[model samples]
Target: MNKAIVVTGTPATGKTTVAKAIANKLNLKYIDVNSLIRTHNLSEGYDDKMKCDIVDTDKLNRILKQMIKDSDQKLVIDSHLSHHLPKSYVELCIVTKCELKELKQRLEKRGYSKAKVRENLDAEIFDICRNEAKEKGHNVIVINTSEGSKDIDDVLEEFGFLKQFEA
Candidate 1:
């Protein structure tokens, strides 16, 4: 059975960055759910304020399931609600996190409005991603990205990804 890693977290938490890095390092396929949604034009809203609201969760879930089923190699999935997907299909689930202030700043820099930034910050503070993972009975690993010195390798090692090196 192929292994899969789900990189989940609130918006602007660097899930995409870490997922991409992991994919590159491990020679795994990187799947950005948000990008897939946009590429397929599956979203209902497109404006700055309503972009997230436009996402059809059911359709998104269906596409993700299909992708998971069809993947021939290991996959690194970057998404906000990755934990909510079928847990049996995921080999590991990682929830990336960061300080609210930094997350807000990152979102703002990315052109998100104040409302969107605050919403994401609030979600992070409330531990929405972590809660979802726990609810799904997944062994979720929390990675804090608040400090600039911490890299993906550090997180991978902390999560025991380096155990493969010993084999």
Candidate 2:
């Protein structure tokens, strides 16, 4: 777990949950990209229509690259924007997905406005994150996090994270 891993996907698609679980299991540092953006003043402005920050992706990537270079601890970077990072800086890029119905429910539960919900739902429906990650030449893995699929530990095992524990 010494290398950097990024968990990226549409909001409410379980990127945070999966990233945090992987970080905890592997003893990696969990870097929340949203917090990083705020802390580093990386936002260009606020997107009123989207109800979110309009970040400078190049700056974000530069800062993240520097952070990865400077840290001794491994990192699990979590955000829908994280997949924008160049592949050379990451060991793995995980893209989470959820059923559209489940994703809509999750977004509504978060109190997102209808427009925001629709935008994010469209992103998920288009597989935007996964496609972008691959387009960037990342070593990518897609995880279906829809309800009743697989739990975190099972997913980890399936990905060979617990190989040493197997009989």
Candidate 3:
């Protein structure tokens, strides 16, 4: 069965909300990768310009691989960087997306600085995370969270989990 799932995208793209929903519905272990990074001291430092942690993807992947190796339950990993884990380690990669206007509102509502907001908007404009996930060879799904057009059940069905959940 598909086991490791990574939820990733530009900030303000509904990654956390969707990831948590999937985990709850599937009875999977929800792993907040940002929390794991802090817990494991995986960040090299903070990026003042970006107003975020400077995570070493190599270190993060190593730790994630270990966690996957040690776990028996399926994992729903949540983070913009979670897609960095090798395709071999992830059964599915879900890239959350938001409309540019909606995303701008979300970032501003979150009290992000103008620069940070612009940076994220640009990332979304260019499909950075999705492209990167694909470049890494992951089995990818694009979820349009802006419209909420993709149902959680439909996503599960697409991932071939509908049969698993049926009694």
The numbered model that scores best in TM-score is: 2
Candidate 3: deviation at residue 5, Å? 0.4
Q: Which pairs clash in the backbone of model 2?
A: none
Q: What stretches of model 3 exceed 4 Å from their correct place?
A: 148-167
Q: Residue 107 deviation, candidate 3, in Å? A: 0.2
Candidate 1 lDDT by residue in tens digits, 17-94: 888877877778889887798788887876667346467767887777777888777778898867777777787888
Ranking by lDDT: 2, 3, 1
Better of 1 and 3 by lDDT: 3
TM-score per candidate, in order?
0.86, 0.92, 0.90
What is the per-residue lDDT of model 3 for residues 1-167, given as tens digits with 9 covering 90 to 100?
34588999999898998888888877888999988988999888888878999999999999999888888888889999999999888988999999999999999999988999999999999999999999999989888887755566665556675336321
- Arranged by TM-score with the best first, the candidates are 2, 3, 1
